[model samples]
Target chain A: MASETDYVTLISKDGFSYVVQRSSARISPVLKRMLDPTGAFLEAKDNTCILQDMPGIVLEKVCEYFYYNEKNKDARDVPEMDIPTELCLELLMASDYLDI
Target chain B: MSGRRGGNRIRGPQSALTDFLAANNISAAQIRDDYERRRQQAEQDAADAGEGPSNQTPEQNDDEALAAAAQAEEAEKKTKKRKRTEKDAIDKIKNAKATKKGKGKKKGKKDEEDDEDGDDDADYDDDFGMYKKARPAPGQFEHCDICNKRFTVTPYSKEGPDGGLLCTPCGKELSKDVKKEQKAATKSAGTGRKRRKVESDRLDGIAVGGAKSLSQLCIQKVAQHHDDIEELGDLPPSVLERLSEIFSKKRVMKSKTLPLFLRPDLDSVIVHDAAYLEEEDYRQIFAIVPNVRKLVLSNTCQLKDGAIDYMLERCHDLRHIQLYAANLVSEGMWHRVFREAGGKLECLKLSWLDAAFEDLVVQDMVKYCPKLERLKLKLCRRLGEDAVTSISDLPELKHLSLQISQNVSTPVLVNLVEKRGSGLQTLSLEKFIDADDSVVGAIHDNCIQLSKLRLSENDTVTDAGYTALFTDWDNPPLKFADFNSTRDIDNNNSGGPEDAIGLASSGFRALMEHSGASLRHLHIASCRHIELSAFMDVFNGAQNYPALEYINMSFCNRADTSVVAGIFKSCPALKQLVAFGCFDVQDVVVPRNVALIGVPRAQDAIEQFGIGIGVDEAISRMVEVTT
Candidate 1:
């Protein structure tokens, strides 16, 4: 969806792939470390990383947040982010895990 | 009326009325005669209709206007032969003359208003006839109130003077006018964002301006929605610790949310606030994580004997414990913990114990916890001289911090220092004002392994004593030191004895010379006897302190611009320099990356000279400005 380059593909455990800009995905330290081009991990060569512990629904929301964070990185008084109630626990764990 | 100046005449065409007059062959006499006939006809009709049209209501205007239009429509055939002299044509000429007169005085006092008293919307509508139509919803087409151009209406459309919607350009013009008026109201309110930021940064702490990091924002969001969080699964120990801090800070760490922070893999459980946590909630901590080795619980008002017993029984691997305001835990339970878990305990810090923890329990703690390495006892009112004398028995105490209420004897402190000072890496005995120079002499004599020292809030330690303490001492350079308020506070004798009661010239110079390289943080606030010569001599640009980063010299008088500049010259690594009450530090530019707190006029230099200037450039600018 994002021209397949300058972006990274995140594959959730439930087999859903999200295409997000590498700059947007750089908000997470885990993703930054995983997508390091210099590192020889399989994710670096292929521009794709598998989040084995996350589901597709939570991963989609995480990608949305990554882009949102990138767009308003230097902004102030930003509006509160929209999140679903059912995924609050899983998302908190994901954010903590990814160190978002 | 026609005797106007030629220069004031139309450059192009003045009004539509004049344009029609130039085009028409008829003179003003013809129009006056036509108006007379219409007036007679209207008077005869008014007598027959039993009323006059003058001062009529809007309903009468509508009725009379419709009748005139019908009459003109019927006479259209005959008027065509008379060169368009219908009633509507005469009305057009009259309306154009009125528009010209209104435009000359106040351009665009609305058309309806210019027509005067009884004129209705249909009688004086603009060419587009947009105002007379029903108001449309947002996203529907409407005409601009001023310019009469059609545009789509939106929720943000500005209203005109007569309640019609304004287009985007008119809206912008209105906003600009409003802003100009507001700006005119208060010129001083233009304090730039940078100055406001600097002022906010000086409220006794660091101010990190800018948006929070993404992770920090997410963590705050997680804390905000803590009630909905079912579980915090497999978060790292450090992240979990930070979450616990946030939860406690928000007072959201009740029994319901306590389990989310508990994980068996985390050895450290820090609950910064526990006011709402009862004894069962405290026991739940031990029940969840029996392997917790390091525990820090503050505001532990309800942690009772049962929780302590459970913690002592369950956590066999507990090595460090720091508790604050745990008054509900009795002295018997503290003795039990010390007796049972003493062999593995490596660090213990307790404070605000007013009712229970007494001298005997402290003596027993020293006897029991042999492996204790760090001890901090603050505001424990029951701790007296006996507890003070008994602390020297701990064999492995490398760090000891105490702020007790009682005034212990000088010999007892000296005896304690003589026994345990050599092994102490840091010793903080704050607000112990009764001890004299003998204790300082003892620290200088017996202390060799000390790297951090604080003997602040004392009136008896003279400048000579501090000089002797640091003059030829064998101790290594300390990394942190705080000797604030070590002054003689006599009302009648403001300045101390001629030799200077507190830290003076030679003592300050000697301390800087000894530890200037390794000292990262030095707090000498309220040490008023520290003279300018000592400050200048210590930071005179010849010596370079490579690692000194922070210094607080509040209330140290005579620290003027020269000493401040000299400090920037000497301590190249200094980041935060605080001189709160020193009024003499004026007309100095703050170097880049260093926060100069408590200067009122600092914004003049920081803003005028610009940010991130080199230290030398800033110092030179200060000289230039002063001269």
Candidate 2:
């Protein structure tokens, strides 16, 4: 039911971009503050964010996880979301920085 | 490559520096050999030149000397180059592999490498580097500095004075000695603070006018000064008064401090706790202050017949006498004191009499003390229905507190209320378990001037009685009301449905609706059978208790968080809400102006939002979860 205006664009360091819904993006507190309507940031004005420290591979995994969490948020029995073992430490560090 | 560096000397792969050195074919031994060969060739050249020196002239001798100086300079430059190369090799060995091995293993490897390079003392110069420092070899025996005992030393050995080594036992003992000295210093400092605290506590105990019991104060004073204080006569009158309070609170008012409290000029003497004063002490008080008008004594077990007679004979103008736990005073003594000295007495309070006081004493008091304005009899078990009925005859009585006297029947109580209830302002009948509907009806019919009523711990007074009492009642709204622990008695022997006693739902609603505007303190704790729906309906936003300041509803488990929240919204002037043992009440927000106690989960809600939230917002948040 969401229109295209409800989506935001996130670009990684290597110029890889992903589009996510506003509700899903708000799950991360950092993204929520950036995209807040009361804020004066460029991200809030243009509905776009750029993360300089995150690589394209790690940003792709983070975007996938946001969607996965949104789907299972109200489910009584949720299925586990799989992540590659080598990417765990980097994902943990990135999530800590994002305050998800 | 392994054989070129000798046998198994380097454990891991060679570093870039070692590889470069090996690639250049510059070994330590080869450099040394070149240096020696050059030195020997120089010596041979010098010897051959010297062989022809004897055949030269003076000019040739000077030229030979100049040539020799030039040769010596060249040799010195060669030796310097060789020394620089040797220093570079030693530096590489020390810096490259220092991190790979332990210190002991590295020392062993260095010794082996020194022998291989044929440089016996080269390692001494290498010790000047930052990474390496020479130390005494491990497992070397040394004497302890304190005990002079020889023991094997390790890297963990403690250093003593003058850089001597101490054995393990001596080091432990020395540290323990230092700790003991520090502990003693701290203990002395702590004792100073403790002494100051005790002095302040004693002063605080005096200022509060006996907050602690008399025996506890006595023990504290005795512990402070082990010996008795004998002389207190020179103290000023105000100081004597304070000392009397201290001695009375300490319960040590014996013969020593008896003279301090007595003077002929003083007209009134009040010993707040007279449990320790013996018979002779009472005689002394009477003998000293014969014109004393107001005398109050608590714990009068030591006052016998002779003491009472002496007081009645000597202090004839005594207008007020209050006695507590005066069981030793006989009925004959009471009759005599009332008949003789009860003409001008305006206040008489006797409490905690086991069996000595009876109906005859009450009759004598009512007959003799015609001008009495206040009469209180508390916990006097032997005073029965006749005795309580006789109190209705006092013409000017105003305050009466009859507590825990179970034998006074309902008819006698109704009779007393009918006779003198209009003049009574404060009536405390706490633990009157036998009071029922008739007594409530009589109070409703007559007691219109009541300002404070305490009917706590009465299990027989039912809801029907309370309902009838509050319905269309004409009395003024009570300022203080206590119905705490007034529940139905669950008779286990009769297996039928339990008859609910005490106040019920509609009765409580009527009481609150009648008195809600002026009630300042209301305690209805442990009234379990009051239905939860009735509680919520009565305390909803439609009903307002504007003057209510303090309320206690502990152990009323059915009133959950929503009911408490509704009470908060309804009572505008509420300041304290106590909800102990109400387990279902959780996460209820309290307003900043009010203090909430004993609601366990409300503490977390307060911590989360702090005391800044508005009342309407808190009520709305609390209601959202319940619905």
Candidate 3:
């Protein structure tokens, strides 16, 4: 299934909205945990406030990666995303902040 | 004020609170005496209660009750003793306030004095703070966060389950776990480690120490000094950040003593000090860096047995290898090296390994390195007919040098000619002893692109062989199968050439009629004899092949100065000539256009001509010969 068809919606802090599939958002464990407290209808308003360093494009891609892999989690390991050098730095810092 | 007292009671130690007040120079002796009196009155009350006989004169119950009431009154008096004390609390507070005011005034005066002193005290305080912030000395470490122990390293590690300052040892252990996990991840993802090998013939000829044992010892040493191998340690923050930026570009330099045979990119590396490496050292070096392309391992005697497999497994980009002194390895060295490094190798130099003279080693080398263009085995006595025959299959081979290797026979050279043919551009078989007619025939028949043919010190080559070899087959259009008819073909411009043909068609006979004039540099020095008919072939030719650049005919007794003079006249394009110790060539016959050099200077001239440079040690010799 397409990542967009799986997740219903993804709202970014910069006010950019993504009507994504549920499976796409579940790609990342952090996003999955975030959805745990707030179900499908709950707004992931924290992306605007919590993730200080994650850029819009990276967040979108990360969400897309998670959405696709969520359905086949048992069969496949997490895909190693070949991120650009600058974004890798950003991810490390951001992940460290989230205590991931 | 009530809360302040409670705060003071909690903050200050009980003994220190009393001591601080007393040592302030305030008089509190009366309070102390009043407390002591109250303590004695309590002791008397306790004794009266224990024994009623002491107050028998009074009504027993009434007396006891009165005594109790009296004791209570005394306790009340002691409890209320602070109110009656002459040391008034108001007076004490006034005195403390006055002293505090005095101290404040003293501090203000000191401040004015400090300003007059150029504010040195203020600057000193700030400097002290800055000095503390900056690292003052090695021992004065900023305390660790995890262990709370004063360590040189600052707090960076995450708190363990048991919260303590993370020390260096703990950090190292954590990092090792991270690395091991990383390796496991990669491995689980189906990526495996690689190995490398060195392409050298077995060095059993030199009888060096055991290859297997030596390598094991080297690995033992590496294991023993494993802690010392600190490729990854506590790097400074800036350096660590930079390293993580381009993690793929990281290179590992094991050591100068250890030669890595198995590396991923083994082909492109040039190792200068891996000559005496043991096998274990070779394995260790290969275990890390697996892929390289251009390898130059000079000494092979020091490497151990299974190390070659390491090179083969790891290095995919390997191409050229310049090996020096590879004669100290065990037997089956070539088989191992070829099994690993055979296909991709194009250029190889094994000139310095004089002890690698085994026949099977040479055959195995030829079986591998099929695309070899340049094969230099100079002075390697172990090289025999097998080595030459093995190379015959290599179609792309251009240069073949077996100089001073006594084991190489004439038949081997013949085989090379028959197989490689016109592809053989440069052939150096100098100082060969058993060069017969079959050898000469091979050169005559197959060496069409033969520019430089050095057939030095072979006594078997006669005058007939000389004339048969030197005559150009392509230019003169003369086939020397009929030696008599071809000899006259140069003489008669008028004759039906088909009718004039006589002798049998032999490749050796063609050499006697001077059928190889396309030859540039000919080293026929120290030959046995040269036929008179061969001498005529040189004189008869006016227009020689344009490519014949250099010629060496030193120490030929049969041909005289006439041979040299004839060469000068016929081959006008000859640039260099060596005729030393020939005794046949007169000094007057020396050509001014061609430089004259001794036997040793020939190599120098060739080097200059090959590279098209003017650096020549032979130039001096030419000048001296002219002067």
Candidate 4:
């Protein structure tokens, strides 16, 4: 699960950087810019972004899926699961933080 | 501005006076002083010239006094001439009627009365008091201040002291004191005259006497002939007490159908509640006055079924009829009104009616209201492309509101905009459903002067529509680098940018990419999900749209702070952004350009941090955030 300490670096289109934590990013959607495909790595670039509320584990999973989705160009829908209410809240927080 | 007076379109002396008055914002006292000075100067000039200003010599020392006397004499002569004309016409009609009715029944009653009245006229010449008494009573003389004509009273004022007293002219001209004395004398001598007049009246009957005398009477005679004329004008002192009692009892029912006293500038009485008038009431009301020029109906009068026929029958002089919320306005009603009074109606507002009847009625309305300039049919659900298309054909139509929910689809609207673009300045489509890119494009292309466009709840329209509408169509180049790039891409790239990779996957995107900076207001309410690519095509590559002062991205599911960051970085002057119900709302990243952010206390979720990020801070940022 994501914790408050996890952070992400966001770069604006003009190449400015802003440091944001996962807990703070969980309430904002700008953090989703980190999921954009550049090359092979998840290195921050010159783009707009914030942070995410998802646990560090969930953030890694989402990034992993984002990577594969970009590579394969997948359009598959996310499957429904019996997710705990707290985890669902964490997902919404992450979605909110990423603004996606 | 010069206007017509006395049947002639001549520039009045007042026009020059107005010019003088307006030239220097002259005060009334100053104008009066100037006028007096001019008059005195004219007098001095007359004195200096000696042979003296043509008509007036120095012998007429009181030139003003002389002029006034001459003018009074001339006015008196003209009044006498007018009185003769009126009296001759009336006498002729009265004699004709008297002869016609009293052909065989000439027991010589009315003839005897006339001889007595003639003798009384002679007596009026001698005593002047007797002449006044012999003149028609105060109520007996009827004159219209409007037409400046006289009408004989039906029963005559035989009951008062001034029975057969003042001639219509004299009664209108005489001082109140002289009139009162004449009234007193006529009452004193009323005995024999009243008897003879009543005897003749009984024999001739009210109707026959009325017709003979009425031919000499213009519409003003109706006021004298009204039921309360005798009760009002020459009522005895004792009768006044009874009248007040009667008035108090019947106050509600006694409301005037059309007020008798009219403002001088208003030439006609506009009966406001004509449509709601009962049949008998309409007949009585119209029968009372024959010179009404305009009648406007009030409220949403349910024409029911037969009311239109009844209204048409009685309202003969009605030039304009406004049926705002009438029920039962069918094709037949439209045809009937048009056929009856179409030549005079200048304005027609018939918006609230059954939709099924609107088109047919509108067609007939246009055909009939030849002088019509304003037609308002807002929310007439029955009106469709046929009505809209036809309405565009009217040359005089200046305003129209075709706000019906229908397939007022692109083609019909485009045709309308093209046809009536210049003439139709105000067109409202408040609840229009089929307003799309093509419709907006046509409006932008053809309707150059259209200032207000109301497409309030129309959700089908996208941002591309605005892009196409606001961007100048003449600027896009046919051969471009993007075009070549798009064509060179693999055929299998389904999701790749089509030749129009700028906005909305159409020429609209190209237009926005080139000129999205021109958009002043962009409303994307209920546009489902916001597309990141479309947003980029508009705000990313373009700089001019500046930051929109107002952005209504309400109810859009995909609104995120990244979009906000883009807006902040690009649009430096954004004043108001209404993203209500935008589920994806996050803390907006304040751009560094604005040194300080004025975040509201209510938006506690947003926090500020100082600028500057060290290289060491970059590597541990992700790990620090993940903790």
Candidate 5:
């Protein structure tokens, strides 16, 4: 029930969804295109995007990395974020898809 | 329970197999004893079978067969025992040797520690002892870790990451890696080095009040007092020279300063840098410095035929004229200039003349300028053999440099040398493609007073020619000799035992033997055919070049680290060595007084033994400031 203007819901293949701020989600070009207000797609109307090819775990890590990058965009020394070794490959594939 | 079961079993004759199983273990001695007993039984059985041959039974034959098998088994056991003992003895000897080597290493370590302690107060004399200890044993051999091949380990052997020794191939690879790493580091550092301050930045410092720029203010000031400006004729020559320098530095020397210096009274007007002077300004120069005896224009890109004609008409007292990059002056104008103004010309230097300076001009200059003592014609590509031959007409010419003239052939060079060699002191025929044996022979036969001879980049000259030139020649020992790139063409075209056409073993030896005593500077770079054996032989032991100071042997592929060491050992007064592409020289220890350039590993040697800061250190400091 989150307002469409404030946040966008991103759902993975496993139906696990994440509600991120509209500004933070816009950091990723793919998400920004999907949630564009002028677009005629269902994602733009509903303010929710379902990434059918990405796993839930990978999508969650991608969302976290996007937020981390947004918060530290201008920082010189950003703190290292930990990603599980098993999830690294999946996260890289998902990031490439999202163009982040 | 097993023992009780064995007791309940019926017992029979104690066979050798049963005895072996009951013993629970088998020894070599036991096997030998059993074999001997069986062999003796076989002999008894054979005797019994022979005695009762008529009534021999199957059981008796079987016993005889078993005895024969035991005898064969016994022979095999004896051989195995002998082999085991031999192996055991070898292991014992190896252990003893290992212990001995360990002890020797410990003693060596102790001696090194003692030497280090004693070295605290040691002087230069003790350096020999320390050096001897530091050098690895020459006869020692070690296996290469990469290929597991045994090779003679020299002092120059490279240590792997784990302290293992590498052979020559692997060592070369590692050295290349080090060079690549150093190159990358220096390249990155070079990017951060000090950038030259731009002209705008310099102007920024001079601009005041921010209302008007410095140039605008200067223009206003000059225009306001244009009539009050003093003529250069009223000022002394020193003040005129200083003003010319300031004007040139500010790039305002073209027309503005020309009028100030162009007066009828001045005899000598020398602008230090007149690069911006156009044709009109040059005309004014000739008009103002009418009676000037010496006129030196460093950069005359805009100078034309009209300016030269003006100079020839007005500056008749000019004895010396040096023009650089004066390509605008045409051929006919040059002929006219030489004919009119060449009467008292003593020194003429025309450089970077791309057009109109050819055989006709040289012939005119030779015919007119008889008093010319020094003449240098550089980058005048149209000059032919006829012009070169015309140079022989100058009887007073002591210094001549004809560079980049490809049309001059061997016979003409020889003729020129024969004609003017006696008076020539400094002759540099650099990049003349046809300077061969005849020219070298001509120089040797005639030029006795020659002090400096630079015959660089002439590929047609052979080793025999060089040998003939230096072998027991009566000419005075040269003070400077540059034979760089003489053998480069020979390396590419010809294929034989003496493929390198310029200088070989005997030629190099003769040159060193003849000129080693008085030679001050020698550059034999890229003389690829100069054999290392000849180099070593000439510089071996007490054969020293006392006066030799600077030598560049860059790109001499045969000259390796050993040849460099030999040069250092023989030449005590050497100051600079440039070994740019001599790849065989690795990890060479240069002398404290000598400056070694283009050597990556020499950086370490320079840091250890050099007097001033090394090149890398200076570059890094500059990089730090700029960054």
Candidate 6:
């Protein structure tokens, strides 16, 4: 199960789409719940979360954080995750929704 | 120099300051007197020249000041001489020390006298280590305080150690130290902010100690930027709920940020603080999230009848409504919401309702809301014995959590529990201080499906009553059990009489024996009578509590390290063990996974070393800890 990585597409508001490992995307509880096979959500059926309200620029950072959070979940004294000041507020709301 | 207010940023290197002074045999007082004399001479000479001497005092350093002061006295002769060389001087100043041999041409006047002073012109350049400043005004030519070479002055000149200025070359060298100090100051400021957050998180129980998890750090960042957030896109309700909590705690849930929580597809709109929200904002919540089934708002001081009516009119899927401190909503408006929309409502929790919700309001809730599964009416001032009687009529009420101000007897509560307890999953009756043993007997007989039970703050129920409630009862083991502050309140006898009242040894042991396997969160915060032996026996290595995670045995005075260590031995899944006021506890080494709280004497050592180590290592480190 650990050897194979499932991929999912995250589409942003400005028609920007990012393909990321499914496990990394599941770092967000909202995404995990939405994409759970047992649950009947459109995003799960298509293996995609529309990310309807997020801009592409913000969505890119969200994808980065998904991997960053997953990579450093158990790590200590890690370097601070860099955030662009201009998009901090947007990413903050997104992160709250994602619960990453 | 200990940051003296007037002190320059770049001083001569510390050893250099003393070395130059000692070698020159110069006292600070003597430097000050000589500097004072030069300044006074310049002023007096300016007065004599009337309009001012063309040969200006350049406000030079200690040694140069004396020479400049002497030049000021001979200003009349130099003015005529400067007129002849003015064109050449302008060209020289413009070249800015490029004419390296300008010092040779200028040697006839000042260099002859400066050479007499010897090493006085040799020191004080740390940065450029080339052109030290002699406080020359812009467009003037002063000798570089370091090499004693001539250089033109500008505003960019850096100050030297002996109250002079350094030229550009020396200025660049001095700034390296300033840059390092700036970097260190910013780094410490960042750490200071992080330390404060950790301290507050420790107090809030968000961080269990040690470092915070990565998600916690991200989530906290999200809370801080709440105002800037336009909307949260399709977040899980749990995270949304937590965001609301964090926002409310941070006092950021205002009119501007409230709109971020509302979405058309969302089934719930929870705002933990509506203190800053007006009636219009409440209407916006209903208008935006029309499908909201679970709407929770606290500190709704401005939620009047108009907004409640709007919510009922627009939100057709409204089922669970919990509003706290909605004192502005009248008794009549609550009636309208319950009567009009209560048919679909399954849960209704109204707390801190000081103004309106009376016994009639609860009666209205019981009468209208037929599908109500969970009902909590706490601190509603008018709720009394009659309200309890009214609540007994609800047909499907499974979860009942109430904190009424009135002294309700055992029978009224017993009647409610017996009528509804068979199908009940959660039953919490808080601060019913007048309730006696019969209510426990009634629950023991009727409540078979109870997963959570809290009958707290009543001193009349003895340990025997609690033991009876758990022993041989057909009810499944409770997932949550809170018997906090149930002890007999007596100032005269601190330990209580021999026949221990409230939850004591026998009752507590029975609770663990029954629920220990399934119990996840247990709060016996002030159950003072539960003896040390009972705690030891329950947590002994012979019995393992597989699912138990969080246990609060605060004020259970007899619980020492032995019992605490036994708990560690028994409950492998335990994460946080809070024992506030457990004074006897001492020198207890906690394992990596568990957070030991409120054992005051041992907290510092635990915070330092108790987090992030295995059980075997912790056991090895465990000393003769309070035998």
What docking class should model 3 receive? incorrect
lDDT of 2 by residue, A17-72 (tens): 99999888887889989888678777888888899978889888788877876775
True contacts kept of each: 0.16, 0.00, 0.00, 0.00, 0.00, 0.06
lDDT of each: 0.77, 0.70, 0.48, 0.45, 0.68, 0.76
Q: TM-score winner among the candidates?
A: 6
Q: Clashing pairs in model 1?
A: A100-B215
Stretches off by above 4 angstroms in model 4 are: A1-100, B1-352, B368-376, B396-400, B405-414, B422-445, B454-471, B474-522, B536-550, B562-576, B588-627
- lDDT per residue for candidate 1 within B1-627, as digits (tens), equals 121224576655346675555343223444577789889878787777756544454533433343333333333354334334433444453354334443322332333243445423333332223223324568755779888876668889888766578888888898888897787545334456744654454343333222234445556778988988887777778778888988997899999998898888789889999898998888889988999999999999998898999998899999999999999888898899899998889999999999899999988899889999999999999898999899989999899999899878888899889999999999998888888889999999999999889988888888888888998899999999899898889888888778788777788888987888798889999999888888888889888988889888989987888988898888889877877778898876876656676654743522222245788998999899889
lDDT order, best first, reads 1, 6, 2, 5, 3, 4
Between prediction 4 and prediction 6, the one with superior lDDT is: 6
Question: lDDT tens digits, residues B175-254, model 5?
Answer: 99999889766654444221112213222332111122212222333333434555423444544554555565566665
Which residue pairs of candidate 2 clash?
Answer: none
Interface DockQ per candidate: 0.14, 0.01, 0.02, 0.00, 0.01, 0.11
**Candidate 3 lDDT over residue span A24-67, tens digit each:** 55544555666553444233433212343556665564454444
- A20 Cα displacement, candidate 6 (Å): 13
Model 6 CA lDDT for position A61 = 88
Give the CA lDDT, 0 to 100, for residue B408 in model 1: 88
Write down the TM-score for model 4. 0.32
Error of 3 at B207 (Å): 42
lDDT of 4 by residue, B84-132 (tens): 4433333333334334443422423333333443333322222232222
User: Which ten residues in a row are the worst by lDDT in model 1 chain B?
Assistant: B125-134
Predicted candidate 4 versus true structure: per-residue lDDT over A57-94, tens digit per residue: 44543443333333322121111122233233233334
lDDT, candidate 6, B1-627, per-residue tens: 122223557755456675566444334545577789989988888788865654443322323333333333334453445546433433333344344334533542454364445333221211112223224567554555555544457788776555466666776777877897798667655685665554455545675544343345555777876767776766667767777888988898888887777778789988888899998898899998999999899888898999988888888888999899999888899898889998999999989988888888888988889999999989988789999999999999888999999788788988988898898999998999988889999999999999999978878899999999999989989999999899988899998877878999999999998998799989998899988889988988779999999899989999987788788888889888888888887777888757777787633532322456776666666754333
